[model samples]
Target chain A: MKITILGCYAATPRSFTNPTSQVLEIKNHLFLIDCGEGTQVQLRRNKIKFSKIKHIFISHLHGDHFYGLVGLVSTFRLLNRENELHIYGPKGIKEIITLQLKLANSWTNFPLIFHELTSKQPELLFEDSKLSVSTLPLKHRVYTNGFLFKEKAGDRKLLIDKAEEYNIDFSLFKSLKKGKDVVSEDGKLIPNRLVTADPPPPKSYAFCSDTVFDLELVPMIKNTTVLYHESTFLEDQRELAFPTKHSTAKEAATIAKEAGVEKLILGHYSTRYENIELFRTEASDIFQNIILADDGEEITVE
Target chain B: MKITILGCYAATPRSFTNPTSQVLEIKNHLFLIDCGEGTQVQLRRNKIKFSKIKHIFISHLHGDHFYGLVGLVSTFRLLNRENELHIYGPKGIKEIITLQLKLANSWTNFPLIFHELTSKQPELLFEDSKLSVSTLPLKHRVYTNGFLFKEKAGDRKLLIDKAEEYNIDFSLFKSLKKGKDVVSEDGKLIPNRLVTADPPPPKSYAFCSDTVFDLELVPMIKNTTVLYHESTFLEDQRELAFPTKHSTAKEAATIAKEAGVEKLILGHYSTRYENIELFRTEASDIFQNIILADDGEEITVE
Candidate 1:
């Protein structure tokens, strides 16, 4: 799995810094998350194919999070896209987008589907053969949700030498990979474990942003392969976190520690600080495995 | 008068090219015109102060022309701007912006004023002591208006030498500048014309964009100092102009020639053409004083 950070700064977009937006590539899907202002231009700069994005997940309705959505939808129409676009966002998202389209009188020729989210509970959003996605309720100034993406385990691996030593017929190889017992050519039953080994463990990633420090999220994101959490401020500005519904770097690291995530990626830094290294320095005290997200940075999950 | 081309392209914004947005600095006022996507960043790149902008004029509701308005407004709120923001656009602009703010729960601390335009005739939109703005109706796929920014004729210039020669008292200098007859110290009446000259012929700039070639604009923008007109296509692609409700370079030149404008600025060129000089070449046959607008180019009207 690969993740690209198109923008991760907080507040307004600047000449060198952008707002919050990212692309998560898992399996065969490219999911766009939290499209902020100038996101389309960021997508172009990052060289991400606009046509490949089919699903978009918005964390909230903040300008830094979802202001670019209408422009992206309009550009898709201008590009003459024919593929269906699915948008999962807050409940009022549809009205905001549709009103702009109506006023402009430029509706998309392709299917534009909107799934307005309002539930406050964890619920499955998408599931296919290889991957599944669900929502993690977040505490913020507005109604918000974080997404969890997980890869499903594949079929067991076959041991060719062991199968042949057991005199297993080649025709039963498929059945053996499916974890089933097979009758060999000699009419002797062979157990599945003897011929095949277990598949690799499934990998999962959790994305959380613009939320206050809450222990409730630890249980939902526990043991994640990678966790991306917002760290809007440092320990020096811890007093601003609760009132603004944002998290400090130490607070994010505490959540990562409690959740036991393998790697914690910190983002959504307020633009007030001149140095971003302070975030990592503060977060490392609680969680040793810390990654600071910058615009145009790409990370790979093993 | 100075005009900065923040973005002067048609259709969607690209990595290097931006959509339609510009700033006209005239008579101590910065008037933003047609805010497209990425305009706020463009403003930052141009080093223009955001606080100086008090009025924004939108030509239409097309995404490329007005998508950045909401983000700009939201940024003003984030910056804690105390000045009132006035937006002039099509009839539905208020609903579109208000809906987004409502959905995001981000109401501006400063007053947000909207002047919705629905007229097909020329109408005054703004007026001050030094300048006045009026609408120039244009033909397009949707309801559209071109803006005409005209400098109000200033108080007649007082020739200091001429006033001294006329023996006018120092206390009567203001009256002489105001073009009123003043009594000299010898009790002789001095005619205003003898002591004053016309203030540099009230420079004007007309911004016409996203519209087809319309002869009716000639009367509205007649004898303007500078004219910025949309030339979306060259003569080679002239066939696409009428159908798309856009103008060719030659057509824009024709309008400039007919309107008797001092200088013609050709912009909003379709991105399909690799060479923009071809637009100037095609237009020069009809209009000699032609300026091709590129992003970040600044023009001074004299």
Candidate 2:
């Protein structure tokens, strides 16, 4: 899985920085998160294929989080996109988009579906053959939810040397790969454990942003391969963090350490700070595996 | 009066050029016309003061014409604009903008007023002591209107030599400049015209775009100081102009000639042509005073 950060700054789009938006590439799916103003331009600058974005997730109703939704949708229609686009966001999202279309007297020829989330608890929002997604309830000024994407474990690998030595029937390979005991042609019972290797480990990615420090999510995102958390302020602005419902770099590291995530990615830095090295320095105090999510940066997880 | 062209391309926002959008400065009022995508960036690149723009006018519902409206509004809000903003456009514009705010749940802190125009006839949309704006009905695929901005004839210019001879009271000079006859202390009636010359002929600017060669507007925009009209095609593609309700360079020049405008500015050229000089070449055939509008070009109308 690979995740590309299109934008990471908060508040507004500037020449050097952009607002919140990212692309998480899992298998063949490109999931877009939090499209702020200038996202389409950023997408173009990043050389990302616009058509590949089939799913978009909005954290809240803040302008910085989803101001680009309407323009992107309109551009898609102009480009003659026929594939269905799925949008998951707060309840008011559909009304917002429909109203724009109504006023412009333009509607998308493609099927545009909205998955409005009103629940305050964690729940599975989407699941397929290879991956599953669940919402992570977050505390913010408005109704918000982060997303956790987990990859499903694959079938056990075959122990080629052991299986061949045991004269395992070729036709029974499927059952043996499932770690099931199979009987050979001579009616001899063959143990699946000795013929099969361990299955590949599943990977998970969790996204949390525009939220206050909330440790309750430790259990929900435990052992995630990568955790991208918002760090809008530094420890010096800790007082401002709680009231604004944003996290400091140290707070994000604390959450990542508590969740035992393999890697902690920090983003959504406020525009006040000109230098971002402070974030890495502060976050490293608690979590050693921490990375600053710069715009256009890509991280690959195996 | 000052007119600045932010963008004038026919289609989309590209790296080198932008779509339709311009800034008109008249009597301390900054009016924005047809906000296409990247308008904010263009404004920033041109170093135009955002706070001075209190009103925005959208010509039509085409995406290329006003796709940047929502982004500008959102950016203003982020910039903490305290002044009220007034938007004038065709019906459905308000709904689209308000719906976006509703969906994002991020309403503007400053007051926003929308004037929805549904009339096909000329109507005064805005007026102040120094200027007035009226819609010029145009023929297009969509309900579109060109804007006619007229700077109200200024106070009569003070004829210093004549005023000195008349011993005009300095305080009464105000009334005389307002074109009012004033009686002197000796009971001598002084004609306002005798003491004052005509205020430097009030400058006017008319913006006509995304419309066909409709000379029916000649009388409505006649004798205007400057006329910025769209010339989306050349004489070679005149066949494609009528069906699309667009005008060619030659056609725009013809209208300017018939209207008796001082200067004609041609813009909104299609990207098919490698060089824009051809537009001026084609237009100059019919109109002597003609210039091609380039992005970031500014003209002072006297």
Candidate 3:
């Protein structure tokens, strides 16, 4: 799985920093998250294929989180996209986008589907044979939700030499890979474990942003391969976090540590901070594995 | 008068080329015209103070023309702006903007006033002691209007030396500047022309964009100091222009020539062309004093 950071700053977009927007590519799905203003230009700067994005997940209704969504939707129509697009966001998202389209009198030719999300409980958003996605209810000034992307276990690896020694028929390979006992050509039953090895462990990524320090999120994101949490401030600004419904770097690291995730990615930095490296310095003290998300940076899930 | 090009390309915004948005600084007002998706960032890049922009003029409801407006308005609220803002655009603009703000629950601290336009005839939108703004009706795919910013005639130059020669009292200087004859200190009547000269011809700027080659616009923008016209295509692509309701370089120049504008600024070029200089080449044939509009380029009206 590969994740690209289109923008990672907090608040209004500036000349050098952008607001929150990222692309998570997992199991052939490119999911756009929190499309802030200037996201389309950032996508172009990063050379991400616009058509590949079939699903977009927005965290909240905040301007910094989802202002660019309508523009992207319009751009898709301009590009003559024919494939259906799905948007998962707060309840009012569809109304906001459709209103702009109605005013412009430029409705999309392709199917533009909206999955309005109002549930505060953790509810499944999407699921397929290879992957599943669910909401992670977050505490913010407004109704918000983070998304958890989990890859389903793949087929077991076939031990070809062991299968051959067991006299398993070639036609039985499919059964063996499915972790089922197979009958050989001679009519003898062979144990699936003797012919196949365990599959690689599945990976999951949890994205949480624009939220206050909440321990409830730790259980929902527990033991995930990667966790991207918003650290809009440092510990020095802890007082400012609660009132604004944002998290500090140390608070995000604490959540990551409690969840025991393999890697923690910190983003959604407040533009007031001159150096983002300060986030790493503050977060690393609590969480040993911390990665700073920068615009245009790509991270591969290990 | 000064005009700053925040974005000048047509269609969707890209990494290198932006859509339509510009800043017109006339008198003490900084007017934002057609805020495309990335306009706030473009404003920052150009170092234009956001607080100075009290008025915004949107030509149409097209995404490329006004998508950034909501974000800009929200940013103003975030900046704790207390000044009132006036927006002049098509009828649906107020509904479109207010709906987004309502969804986000981020009502502006400043008063956001909307002047919805539904007229095909030239209509006055704003008037002040120093300047007046009117809508220049244009032909486009949707209900559209170009903006005409005309500086009101300034006080006639006092001609201090001539006033002294006439022995005019200092208390009557204001009357002399107003082009009124005043009794001199020696009780002699002084003619206004003898003591004052006409102030530099009040400058005007007409911004016409996303319109087809319509001669109906000529009378409204006639004899403006500078005219910024959309040249979405070159003459070679003139066939595509009429169908798209966009103007070609030569077509824009034709309008400029007929209007007798002092200078013609060509913008809103289609991204299909690699070199925008070709627009100047194509337009200069029809009208001289052609200037190609580019992102971040500033032009001082002569």
- Going through the candidates in order, the fraction of native interface contacts each one reproduces equals 0.83, 0.32, 0.84
Tens-place lDDT per residue, model 3, B1-302, is: 89999999988999888899999999989999999999999999999999999999999999999999999999999899999999999999999899889888888889999999999999999999999999999889999999999999999999999988889889999998888999998999889999999999999999999899999888888899999999999989889999999999999999999999999999999999999999999998999999899999999975
Residue A128, model 3: Cα distance from true site in angstroms: 1.2
Which wins on DockQ, candidate 1 or candidate 3?
3
lDDT of 2 by residue, B14-104 (tens): 5577789999999999999999877887888788999899999999988778877887898899889999999999898988788777666
Q: What DockQ, between 0 and 1, does each candidate earn?
A: 0.86, 0.43, 0.87
List model 1 lDDT by residue over A1-302, tens digit each.
89999999999999999999999999899999989988999999999999999999999999999889999999999889999999999999999999889888889998999999999999888899999999999999999999999999888999999999999989989998889999987889999999999988888989998899999999999999999999999989989999999999999999999999999999999999989999999999999999999999999987
- Could you tell me the lDDT of residue B84 within candidate 1? 93
Cα lDDT tens digits, model 2, A168-254, are 879889988777988867778988888898887889899998899999988999999999999999999899999889999999999
lDDT of 3 by residue, A93-158 (tens): 998999889888899999999999988999999999999999999999999999999999999999
CAPRI verdict (incorrect, acceptable, medium, high) for model 2: acceptable
Worst 10 residues of 3 chain B by lDDT: B99-108
Best by lDDT: 1
Q: What range of 10 consecutive residues in model 2 chain A has the weakest lDDT sum?
A: A96-105
Model 2 chain B: which ten-residue window has the lowest total lDDT?
Answer: B10-19
Winner by DockQ between candidate 2 and candidate 1: 1
Name the lDDT value of residue A23 in candidate 2.
93
lDDT of 1 at A147: 95
Report the CA-based lDDT of candidate 1 relative to the real structure. Answer: 0.94
